[model samples]
Target: MWWFTQGSCFLPFFLVVWSSTSFILSYLIALFRRDVDVLFPYISDAAANPPESCIFGLMTFVSACAGMATIYSRFKFVEKLSEETRVVNPQLNKTTLVLGILSCIGMCVVATFQETAVTAVHDVGALLFFVSGVLYILLQTVISYQAFPHESSITVCRVRLAVTVIASLAFFPTVICAFFVKQTDLHRVKDSKDYPFHVASAVCEWVVAFSFVCFFLTYIDDFKRFTLRVMTELG
Candidate 1:
């Protein structure tokens, strides 16, 4: 567990799993409590309610940890790439790292500001997370391609690029629909049926989340050696 926590690649893996599972469990509990409407309730809605609020809060906190760790891992990986390509492009690397950190901050903000308590702030956080995520993936995809042109994992990176692209495309439309529906007072009405747009948004949001997680899987190959190490410091 310590290896998983401290390892660069493994940290992201653990975080992805932890965050996803925590949110799912929280959502289920929220559903049972009937605090959130079943059909169109956003991910934030589950975290905002009772009985699952703690779980959701933990998820967000863990997400913040993952985000910061990811920034570190990215910086290290970029350094390695510089050695491989024999080219020093600090500007590009810095940009990718900055965007990654911003995306992480956005996620933390989302977790901190629930849709129920602060709708606008929550929306801003979501926007920051998703938009920065898209930019990070796009930039990293290009960097990975350039950095590892001869490596076999480049193919895998390309595949991840495809997934990120699809997720980004789906994310915008669904989020737009979800927010548009929010403006109609459907979410506020107690007796309203589940709105399709909200449901779609929820589904797409999950896809976006999973897609982003999948993007990080490629890093495992890069950092597998770190996992194999039992200790960073030897006596």
Candidate 2:
């Protein structure tokens, strides 16, 4: 019952499953309607398409839930550390918690304001989600290393730290390149459909999304150790 709280390890797996399924399904639906070129359309384009937009909105809401669950899990981990040492570091924990909450709220905003309905609000929400994601990755990597310094894999925590850094670094330029190309294609190129630059931008966007998802793998091993208890017996 306690593990059923927001911090449940199962939450990450659920987040991953729902987010991935919704994304893939939205893309497929977009393709079915001939509204987007599956190979070249931006992920957001799927959300802009008819019917599939519903799936996209669902994904964003699920993402928001994942973010909140992450905050709770991180808070619990910090509390565990403090309990062991009999000392609390409120500032760092609080900062991480706040960032996670902001990231979740950003996802909600993105969901509420679809790109077709309100481009500016959607863009702002997306930016907030991503910027906070980058910061959260950096902070969590540091926290993971400091929290579990002794993990073996010649240091599993260190490997995960490296991965988080690399993924975020890769995400940074891809997002910028994608945004720049998309903007240029929309305003200047005019023949944006499946154009080389357009395709490149789409690919970059995909890479950024994938890299962010991969960042969560840093917690996979830890998730394995989480305990779950049954609270009620079947009648």
Candidate 3:
């Protein structure tokens, strides 16, 4: 949707090219290596193609939309913290602000590409999306750590640490999608039946979806509690 990503017809884009190459290489690495055989067997889809999409589409849309919501909430949190706090570590605010916007941009870009650009940017944007989610979770954790109460960045640290682990766990399937690509029948935008890829995609989305749900339900309280305790200490 943004100019940065649109109308740049086959610009020999460095990132996309790098990603495609990485896919091939990773696949080869898995193929030749014995360990990867075991690994791939676990991750690989036994089914010929992904399952039907009526339900899958809804689930994908919901997870993606909820991810957008969580990122938006993060933006509001950062804005509030920045105005309330002084310049102790302004870089934290800057990173959170920029990455939060990027998270939204990344999501919108994929949605748009998926809708149009049938042959061009669809999966490419999706790959970028995988990376974007990674960046989103990382930056959010950084913001949490930096804006944590000065008295005990420790508790916040633990929380962020947990967040990071969950985020990382949440990230593996995107990598799997990247690896399988069109080769994996389930992930293909066109009619494909790779059931395992679909299952993997579902699993990952479930993790991310639940992660954000827990984040909103639990971490909103954490943020509010942290803010109040900080203010009380300062007062």
Candidate 4:
């Protein structure tokens, strides 16, 4: 259809909107239910209980799937560009795809395992999701630089670099503060001695997560000019 032919941009756009909506909606629900403090709560804390848990799980799972599709499409786009430009490293392109896929898988794991119900598993999932996601974007930024003045503009590269750096800088504090946070009660985190650490970690987490959404937003223009097609053959 003509719409599909011109709608490649929709993938990244949907991802940005959908993932942001999932987080925001879950946070609002948690706040309304008093499941979490009005102060900054860890992303997981915001969706740790039902029925918010159920909503968060389903929404995040769909977002993860959309993320996977968007990443795969990106991989294909870069591969095609490489074939045309001969400037892109084939190995790097493949590696980026692997990292992106792993990140999406991590997102799925995070969605499936609720932190309060399965703390260890959820933490592992969050680790995988955040670490891999950050690395994926960093690699993608490098790729964008490599494609510079050819398939990409200097301004676009700078924007991607900025986002990557912000996410990377926030990541360390998010992890460190989260580790030192001794508040076991999510609702009473603000009342705990470790409240500052909890708030710091949560704020950093949100920063990193939104950084991801902003990074994907940069893909919209590139995606706009590229369209995917499926071919079937019986041999």
Model 3 RMSD in angstroms:
15.1
State TM-scores per candidate.
Answer: 0.82, 0.78, 0.49, 0.96
Off by over 4 Å in 2: 1-7, 86-89, 150-155, 182-197, 224-235
Name the TM-score of candidate 1: 0.82
Give a tens-digit lDDT track for model 2, residues 71-131.
Answer: 6775776666666764446577778778878877877887778776888898788778777
Best by TM-score: 4
Error of 1 at 36 (Å): 3.1
- lDDT per residue as tens, model 1, 1-235: 5555454567667766776787688879988888776765667777786658777877777877876786667677676668676654778888988888999899888887777678889889999888888888888787777666533276777787798788788788666867556433324454445355666787788778777777776666566444332457778
- Prediction-by-prediction clash tally: 0, 0, 7, 0
Runs of candidate 4 with Cα error greater than 4 angstroms are 1-7
Prediction RMSDs, each to the true structure: 4.3, 5.5, 15.1, 1.8
On lDDT, the candidate that comes out on top is 4
Taking the tens digit of each residue's C-alpha lDDT, what string does model 4 give over 1-235? 5432365988998899999999999999999999998878888888899988899999999999999999999999889988999878989999998999888888888888998788898889899999999999999999999887776789989999999999999999899988888767777535577888888888999999999999999998888788898999999
For model 3 the TM-score comes to 0.49
- Candidate 4 residue pairs in backbone clash: none
Model 3 over residues 96-213: C-alpha lDDT tens digits? 5566455545544544443222525645655455565556567666666666673226665576567667867867875575455445222234345554665476567545533433
